[model samples]
Target: MFKLLKYADKYKFYAFLCPVLMIGEVVFELLIPQVMANIVETIRLTDTADAAVQSAAVNDIFLYGGKMLILALCSLFCGSLAARIGSIAGMGFGASLRLGLMEKIQTFSFSNIDRFSTASLITRMTTDVNTVQNTFLMLVRGFFRAPIMLITALVICIRKSPDIAKVFAVALPIIILFLAIFAPIAIKRFRAMLKKFDGFNASIQENFTNIRVVKAFVRTDYEKEKFKKSNDALTAAAIHAEKIMVLGEPALILLMYFTITAIVIIATKSIAEQTLDVGEFTAIFTYAFQILTSFLFTIMILVQVFMAEASAKRIGEVLYETPDIKDPENPEETVSDGSIEFKNVSFSYGKGSDVIKNVSFKINSGEMVGIMGATGSSKSSLVQLIPRLYDATSGEVLVGGKNVKDYSVYGLREAVSMVLQKNVLFSGTIADNLRWGDKNATDEELKNACEIADALSFVESFPDGFNTDLGQGGVNVSGGQKQRLCIARAILKKPKILILDDSTSAVDTATDARIRASLRRLAPNTTKIIIAQRISSVSDCDKIIILDGGSISDIGTHEELLSRSEIYRDIYEAQQKGCDDFDSVGGAS
Candidate 1:
């Protein structure tokens, strides 16, 4: 837990002031008992004195009472200052830690992100960070205050009555032993609770993200049951952890009452025998309460520390995770052209069998190439390597005649614009979302890119046109519209290499053909690689590669593939028959 304190370095001054001010408060608190004792002793001595002596005793009582009041006010002021400083320091530390965690996540490659679940990361950033923040506040305030106050009060009590103070020596160790034995159990339970929290968050994220699918399938009841199971598991874990923590409170209370009873019984005997004065006895009794109370506070703080320890471990895992992909010490700053080559490239998600095995291919700059493959043919995985989203497990992937790893990640990615299979858009105006590809793109540039993607007509028809707000994840738009917008955004980059990974799958065949035609005219020099399931989508390409499983089954033009490749011929025949059937139905109607 202490290893993570480096993030709080900026707030060191505030952290330092908290403990110092708390110590000042403890000093004032220690003096209050002595002042009260002085007032009591004065009253006792003046009980049988002359009138003048009694009058003087009244003055002494007033003097001591005023001193006690002032001490209390000073203590309150110091404590308030400490609490204010502690809050600032603790909150600032949390903010810094969260920012640091987010920054680290941004640097992670796709594989690194895959190592941790989205729900787990969210839990660490929020719940785990909050736990650590509260623990820091307790450390700066109660942790210091309790021990300082306890030691000061204990010393005063011992000075007043040595025999009575002996009770603490025995009681303190017993309390410590009790906490020592139970703390590990609580920590383990808290860790388990955090895991449950991850499960609960995962359920919520999954259900919300796929709400349309759930509703479409009429599986609301099933989703509800799934969520209830996750929620119940979290509740059970929380209760199990709290039950152990709850045990500490009752045990502490019992020990406190027992210690106070022992002190009172012993002090009563001492007072009756005149071995301990009434004034001194009263002071000792107050000190006994103060000492035990501080001990109790310390134990509570320790319990929180144990819980925070679990949080710290979870947070540390993210902060310390190194990205699997990183640029070399001296990387090339420029990409020569869009030419790409994959030589015997093989990759696996983990230690499993290779998804793409010994695959080799090359595409020249300024050429239009099409990739046809079945589901799970590793088409998307193959293109992702060009942007270094995931590095090849074996062999080399070269872009622009240079090994991809040789070029800086940012520079290489800038030259390659890819519209992935999954289209995502942020909550913003249509113009804002388009500007993600080129932040400085002007109105004309945006219009031209949208025109090429065949999205301008629909965008202009909207009431607000380009200024129209796209709700979160572009939920307000149809799937085809979202795909077109993503394509337009990619087009705005005007990259050397443009990859459309089934990006036009949602659009009608005619619209898809129009978009491809616009791309040929507008970006004649840019290398284009289109991955499509529909054979007509790639029939006119300069070259067509048919991927079977993970390997390229055949590579040729449409005419050559139709005569030589069985898989390509079969897919082409199926799509052609479907189109003919649709035409015949239209004629009959």
Candidate 2:
């Protein structure tokens, strides 16, 4: 909880002013009751006075009351100023905290993000931050004011009569006893409520992300049932927490009623004996009620603190998480020779068996290499390390003869551009998407990139051409168009090393051939790596490497591998049959 205080401390000026205003409000509130009591006592004393004398006394009393009223109103105006300051300060604190958390998460390694879900992070940023904000506002208003009011009321009560003051002293111990009994239970219930909230968030996020899957499988009813179960669990936990919190009000009331009754009985007995004045007894009773209510409000604030504390801890856990992949202290930069080398590199996804075992490879500048593999052969995992997405479990990955980890992440990635198999397109125009690769690209450059990726014809056909609006995630575009756009974006980057991870999977054979031919002509200097399942995709590359069981089974030119490698031959035969079937079907007419 104290970790959240750093945000408040950043704008301490506002925090300080907020409480000053709140104290003014408390002062006005304190004076109002005392003034009202004074008026009542004055009337009680002058009950049988002559009309002229009584009129004079009443006018004097009204003047005093009115003075206090005006002062109180002035204090309230100051209090409102304080509240505005606090609210603005609290909002600033929330905004800063959110940005800090997001920046920290961005620096965290991919493995670290995998340890938690996206929904949990979203909850921490939104719901948990709100909890902290509400608590912060309460701190500004209640932290000092509650204690000051209770202490002042206590002093006033004692001044009225030591006998009456003893009543509150006795009640204090009993109230503390009830608080001690119930507070731990309340804290436990609040923690349970947060877990239920996480579960509910996870359920909603998963259903929304996979809504199409649910519909395709005709499982809408099943998904609803799953949602209801999570929702009911959260509801039950909240109700249980509410039940415990509700107990505090009744318990305090029960205690207040009994304490007040005892004081009333004792004071009346004193009145009968002529030991206590009617006015003095009424004043003492008012003071005692004020003290009790102040104590009750203080307890309510304590309960709220407990609830927000749980949320604060959740937010802290994410903010404080250290990235599994750390950058080297002494950095080195790579000059774009477009050379890459893997020396005895071994890696695993945690304790699982080695996904890439003792892999060794070297590529010269401007070489085009193809990595072909069956599923789970570690093709994707191997390339992921070159960008330092994951560190090698052993050995090293080098670019330009320097260890890849020796370079800053920004510098390292700027030289590498990847068009992955799962192509993603953002919500933007075709030109906007292409400019992400080269922000200063001119119209001619964008058109040239589109043509190289064989995307120019389709883009030109759109109503707005390059400026046509692409819907969210490019849902308005076909799979082939999305792939082509991603390729164009990568081409526009003019990276030293370009990677296409089965990027041509969506295009027809003719388009794929044209795109490859364009790349050969336009980016002859760029080092290219192509990963594919189909042999046709990589047959023309400078070198073809076949992966089986997480190790390179064969590495050579297409003709060399086809003639000598059994795995390559089998894959080539399979692709040949697929092409034959397609051609026969087309020629049937």
**In candidate 2, residue 458 scores what lDDT?**
90
Least lDDT summed over 10 consecutive residues: which range in candidate 2?
580-589
TM-score of 2: 0.94
- Compute each candidate's TM-score over C-alphas: 0.97, 0.94
List the pairs of residues colliding in candidate 1: none
lDDT of 1 by residue, 504-540 (tens): 8777777888899999999998999999988867999
| Model 2: colliding residue pairs | none
Predicted structure with the largest lDDT when compared to the true one: 1
Which portions of model 1 show Cα errors greater than 4 Å?
Answer: 579-589
Off by over 4 Å in 2: 50-52, 273-275, 325-327, 350-353, 583-589
lDDT of 1: 0.90
Q: What is the per-residue lDDT of model 2 for residues 1-589, given as tens digits with 9 covering 90 to 100?
A: 8787886767789888888887887777767666766777677645755887788668868876797789788777877888898897788788878888899899987678887789999889989989888888887777777778788878977876777778888898999899888988988988898888988999999899778789999999999999999999999999998898788878789999989998998889878887777767776777778788888878878877888998899889988888887767976655456789999999988678899999998888788899998988989888888878788999999987788888877778778888877778889888998999999999999999999998999999988999988977887888888899999999998888888988877676667767878888899988889888767678899998888887888899999998999999988898787753553233211
